[model samples]
Target: MALFPPKNPVPTPTPVPMPAVTKPSTLPPEDINRAKQLGTCIRARFAQTLVGQDNLRESLITTLVAGGHILIESVPGLAKTTAAQTLATSVSGSFKRVQCTPDLMPSDLVGTQVFDFATQKFSTQIGPIHANFVLLDEINRSNAKTQSAMLEAMAEGATTIGGQCIALPKPFMVIATQNPIEEEGTFNLPEAQMDRFMMKAVMTYPTAQEEQRMLTMLTHLGSDTFDSRTLTGDVVSISDVEFLRAAARRVHVSDAIMKYAVDITATSRGAGTKPVQGLSTLVRLGASPRASIALTRIGQANALMQGRDYVIPEDVKAFTHEVLRHRILLTFEALADGVTSDQVVDSIVQAVPVP
Candidate 1:
């Protein structure tokens, strides 16, 4: 009794379980080194399969690394479809070509519900949009309804059928091709849908020498060419491709650069330039927040593709147009005056100070 008990017993607090600390990948030394090696191999392989268009090819590669969609506008027979197919082959991804026409329907691109007489219930028949790489050939040729069908998958990466949303395959990308020369039967993509694409690239005709070389290559290769050689026999597994994209989310971007991207985009809206040019004056709409995001990722991807561990201003500059062009919308007045979106973007880039 004299000894009694300890003055008072204290209650101990339960330990809070912290998230598993992930060790930062020091594998940059190894991973990036291998990525660069694969990139080199890809470049060499593409050079053989395709001629010229170095800029476009690099942009396409950057798009893949950036995990974004691309819209290619060009005349027919310029290998637009071939370029998309070759790209898919290089990545060893499933490819599907959608011949968009006026008669094309939403179900045509995203599948539809079918009545299974035996089962006495409706079943979902998936469409070509389920693949890893989809070539929306002549997208502009499709009617507004048909074009709208792609909006969901392009933006959400999934299609809803029979009240259930089906996720697209990993590394999914839609490389849409539109013929800008022919507007007679073509339906221009509404501004809303255009912005869904990360970049709108124009595929121009090859030069005389390049064309002649392409012709020679075609004539000389008599059934010797396989569909397309696999770049690494599996350099990037589907899962690995998903992982690489997840890693991109961790790509560091300083606030300074983020502001730079915003400023450049905001300036396109109403911020004035030398003559006080405002996109509102000429543009019906300005680039959205998604545009900024695309720029950041694409910029980081551009840096990574060049074997750099970090992103820089040059990367942003290189990707600015592609990221912003399609997102910016010019008014009818601007169109009547022949003021193109490219010109507007150029002005904004010049006006916005580089960081």
Candidate 2:
């Protein structure tokens, strides 16, 4: 023991708990089984009825299980309305079809007040918006006021009558169709109104084989009532849809991915650098923060549809076209130069790197 003030003891270093790096959950076997079964059921039904449209079928399943609205854009007779109506029938939910026109009114879609002679008071009458599933055919044919009425219901999940609010049914989702060819009699969907839709899908012409199949089916079903065909009620339900929504909210999105979304949107607006995709030059408006949130939510649902418990870069990439295309607005110059919303979305997806 050579003294040096007894060699002052170094205080034991207190161990600080390192922040936990949470691991993303792997796909649960049970969820995978259920999702696959649901996918199979949807395919079996859609395959017999619709020819070609692999993309449409997949997107429809994703949208349905994800609890989001869909917008189908196409020329008339492209099966846009038929596809929507088929899905509504398969879901076994209350389905209402509203043929949008210039004369359509707000009260027409969301109901109005009626006088009750017996009770000597006004009673609230519900509208087609109260259904679990809606087919808004040729939505662009409506005037601005009528469009606004539909938009308000889609955004708020409720309708107002006589200053009173009535909540819509559970699992409420709209499948709207627009004829892109006729612009003269139609009102363009407002940018804000377009953003309310979770997905914007274009319905293109089917292949030769698909067309043959469609023609054959139509010929066989002639003079028969199509209304008799019904879907199984137990396979899916409004309550089940609510549960899927809850599960979607729980899907984990990494911070790296979040930053990627922010950077992409920022780049579009020329926030700190030269614009990408000629976005600053062509776009009068960029997507709002709501677009980011919608993307993440739909991405999660897309993942779950694929039997994954966590979202991957692929999920985000697959859905960007549908989620962002309608949100971005192009200037007149951009339209003249053949720049469309889909082109801008494609540019953003290419510019943003995945984690």
Candidate 3:
């Protein structure tokens, strides 16, 4: 299936462009340069381990800088797990991979109170969710109950263990992967849980050149398994991640830009005083306020990566599909007509006025 509809399916509306703002970014020049260096370092490290999927790499970095969780959907053998693992290992922190299954219990992800016979006392044993980077491979393979257990950690960065709330490590992020091809024995993620993610990235197959490079790399290694830890010398420290996030937060966001984001989200929902045309019928539900916030923050991250202190319309437009795809729910008619969330988002972007 096509990820998006044909170009210009919806009549292109003349964008009512707003006057450009002359304000500069709040971040200092040194900080902006540092952010760019960090972003480059991460991409370079990812290139050493993973073959291609530039969009996936950028999405991961943007989400990391924005301090948000991500949901990755793709078929098997697309290196979804490899990408997540490479991102985790590129940073100097604890990394954990949870292979989700139907029988996986909540305690398997969080933690449980264990009774120790040797000490005649109960001790708290934390689970894999406490790590800095957590890769939940095949997340949908687990039952809803087990999936919901991650809510607390993802939202609040803390989990309640035996009536005690334990804070997770800082610089924490969840990169969840789910196979779209296999639906049997897999439970769908709840809407509430879905909304918790800042962005949902969809990975696609690589090009012929990229695949050939993969084959060459595999032949050079003489094995199928690729160890991402080979680039330990170039690992980005936790402090660097914190600094990059701080810099991203400092990236300037104007009121007009904020309004543009809200407008795009509102148009998708077909809500407010003036909803954009041609979207109400296709959308069962629009993106939430969180999506608006995500759109703005992701723009900030993108701007920082580009060595700019201020966000532009292009930054927000660059990630609109990723930010709003999983958030919007489609109607029966839209689905029957083979409409995707990407198409809906594309139409909204074209219809909304740019600031």
Leading candidate by lDDT:
3
Tell me the tens digit of each residue's lDDT in model 3 across 291-335.
999999999999999999999999999999999999999999988
Report the lDDT of model 2 for residue 59.
Answer: 74
Q: Could you give the candidate ranking by TM-score, starting with the highest? A: 3, 2, 1
**In model 2, what are the clashing residue pairs, if there are any?**
none
The collision pairs in model 3 are none
* RMSD, every candidate, angstroms: 8.7, 8.5, 12.3
Name the 10 consecutive residues with the lowest summed lDDT in model 2.
Answer: 224-233
Model 1 score (lDDT): 0.78
lDDT of 2 by residue, 1-355 (tens): 5565576789999999999988666556776667666667666777656778877777777787777898988877787877787777766568999999899999999999999999999999999889999999999998899888898899999888999989999889999999884566877888778988888888788889888888887787673234426433334555656766766766777887676666666655655233474467888888888767767777788877777787787887787777777778889999899888888877777777677
Candidates 1 and 2 compared: the better one by TM-score is: 2
What is the C-alpha local distance difference test score of each model? 0.78, 0.78, 0.89
Candidate 1 runs further than 4 Å off: 1-27, 223-226, 229-236, 272-280
